[model samples]
Target chain A: DAGVTQSPTHLIKTRGQQVTLRCSPKSGHDTVSWYQQALGQGPQFIFQYYEEEERQRGNFPDRFSGHQFPNYSSELNVNALLLGDSALYLCASSLNGGVYGYTFGSGTRLTVV
Target chain B: GQQVMQIPQYQHVQEGEDFTTYCNSSTTLSNIQWYKQRPGGHPVFLIQLVKSGEVKKQKRLTFQFGEAKKNSSLHITATQTTDVGTYFCAGPYLSSNTGKLIFGQGTTLQVKP
Candidate 1:
């Protein structure tokens, strides 16, 4: 069975623009979470979605929002992105309520130029 | 705010040597998970420890959870070149409204042959 998958392995965006990254969770997984990882740093939690609703959120601003579809696929949207937004956007999927181990996608690298 | 920190920002070891990384949390955690990220790759789930003073092993890797539930460690015996990557420890911090997983700065390991 295929594991978690993310689209557009790499993306480049300009300041003030917007970008959307997609992720398809592992089969049978119900919860999806997003994280941002800067170079040489650990992944920072962005938010988590469960049952097609945002169950939890991190310290990210409203500029960073996300949606999880009924199929358990998720999309992370960034509005008026800034250079600081340049990082690796990672998608992680977990079973139940995210209290278990997570399967992560290769992540989408976003470069703001 | 809950936070996690890792020691020895980076380590370089020759193949067949041993290595260890420590993770500490500012607050108690219900569970802790570990992941490994290779250069230019996504983070992969390694293991999870829940009970305090718990210990588990996967082949050459040993995982431990502190008695206080606020610290963890990952130890690798006889490292190999294939083990080069950054190891991250993460745990969830529960709040009234939302719960988020916080990741440590990570321990980057370089295994040279």
Candidate 2:
């Protein structure tokens, strides 16, 4: 079985521009969550998507948004990116509410220039 | 806002030395999970603890959850070079069923062989 997969392992974006990162959850999983990991810090929750709707969100601002497709794939969009937006974006997936067995993707490294 | 804090942001140990990392949460948690991330790699699920005062062992690694469900710890016996990585403890926010996790700052372990 395939684990969570993320696209564009590494990306470079300029200030004021926007970037979209994609993720495909592991097979037999329906819930997807996004996290941002800055240098020398733990991953911070961004939001979670279940059944094509956002179920929970963290303290992030409106500049960060996400979408979940019917197939359980997800996309994280960051608008008006700043240099501080540079970080590793992680995608995790699990069954149901992830009471157990959560899988994480290698993550997309976003470099805001 | 719920927060998870970890101690000893970094640790360096001899190849055979033991290591441990502590995690504390500002609020009670229904369950807690652990993950390990190697250099230049994504975080991988290690284990999860649910019941208060629960303990689980995985080979040389032992995991414990506090009696109040607000703290947890990971202990590694006889560490090796392969154990060099950052260990994170995470738990869901109160009243959240969407699998959004609040992660600790993480303890980076460096084992010298």
Candidate 3:
């Protein structure tokens, strides 16, 4: 079976512009979470979506938002992008609340120039 | 805010040598999960430790959870080139909530043949 998949492996955006990243969860999975990882750093949780509703979010501001489709796919949208927003955006999927290990996608590398 | 810190941000070892990375949490955690990310690749699930003082082994890799649930460790015996990657530890901010995660900065390991 195919694992978690993300679209647009790489992207570039200018300041003040917006970007949308997409993810398809692994088969039989329901919950999807997003993370941001800067170069040489670990992934930081952005938010999680379940049942087509956002369940929990990290310390990120309103500029970062996401949505989950009925099919368990997800989209992470970053508005008013800044230089600091340049990073690898990861998408992970789990069966439930993620108590078990999470399956991650290769991630979308966003370059804010 | 909760945070996960990892030690020895980078490590280089010879083939057949051993290596270890420690992860600590500023707040108590309900469970800890480990993942490995190869160069230019996405993070892959390694293991998860839920109970206090829990220990789990995967071939040459051993994972441990502290008695207080505030610390964890990943030990690799006889390291190989395939082991060269960034290892991350993550846990939820709330013990009962598994939707969000606090990830360690990650330990980057390099193995020389």
Candidate 4:
């Protein structure tokens, strides 16, 4: 299996601009989760998608939103980005309703200038 | 919201030395998972512990879940260049159905030959 796949390995955006990151879940997986990792820090949970609906959210503001498609692929959309928003965005996928380990993508590096 | 805290944000050790990172959660967890991220790489799943007071090993790495399920740990028997990375412990939120993970801040290990 290809495991999780993310698009746009790196992105550079201006403050106040918006960015969208994409992720394709691993084969046979049905759940997708997004996380943000600042330099020298562990990933912070952003949200999780299952059955094309957001089932859980973190402490992040509503400016961070996401969507999961029918094929279990996912997208993370950040609106009105700030310099502090710059970080590595990670995507992880796991099987729903089962005890399964998560598969993570290489992640997209977002730099807000 | 739950919180996972890790200690000693960074560690520098000589090759062949042992190292350990600890993780504690604000609330009891049903399961705990560990991940390792090489510099400039995404987090990769290391192992998972589902039962309280359970321990598992992988080569030189040992993982343990607390008796109360409120904490966990990762121990490396011998340091190596390959073991130089950030280690993270994560657990699912108490009320999450989508299996969203709350990750600790992580402990970065630097191995010197």
Q: What TM-score would every model get versus the actual structure?
A: 0.96, 0.97, 0.97, 0.94
Predict model 1's lDDT versus the native.
0.90
lDDT by candidate, in order shown: 0.90, 0.92, 0.93, 0.89
Those runs of model 1 whose alpha carbons end farther than 4 Å from true positions after fitting are B95-99
Candidate order by DockQ, highest to lowest? 3, 2, 4, 1
Kindly report which residue stretches of model 2 are placed more than 4 angstroms away from their true locations once superposed.
Answer: B95-97
Per-residue C-alpha lDDT of model 2 across residues A8-112, encoded as one tens digit per residue:
899999999999999999999999999999988999989999999998898899999999999999999999999999999999999987888579999999999
Interface DockQ per candidate: 0.63, 0.78, 0.86, 0.64
Q: Give residue B58's lDDT in candidate 3 (0 to 100).
A: 97
| Model 4 segments more than 4 A misplaced | B95-98
In TM-score terms, candidate 4 sits at 0.94
lDDT of each residue in A41-73, candidate 3, tens digit only: 888889999999999998899999999999999
Which is the better candidate, 1 or 4, if ranked by TM-score?
1
Residue range B50-89, candidate 1, lDDT tens digits: 8889999999999999999889999999999999999999
- Look at candidate 1 and tell me the lDDT of residue B97: 21
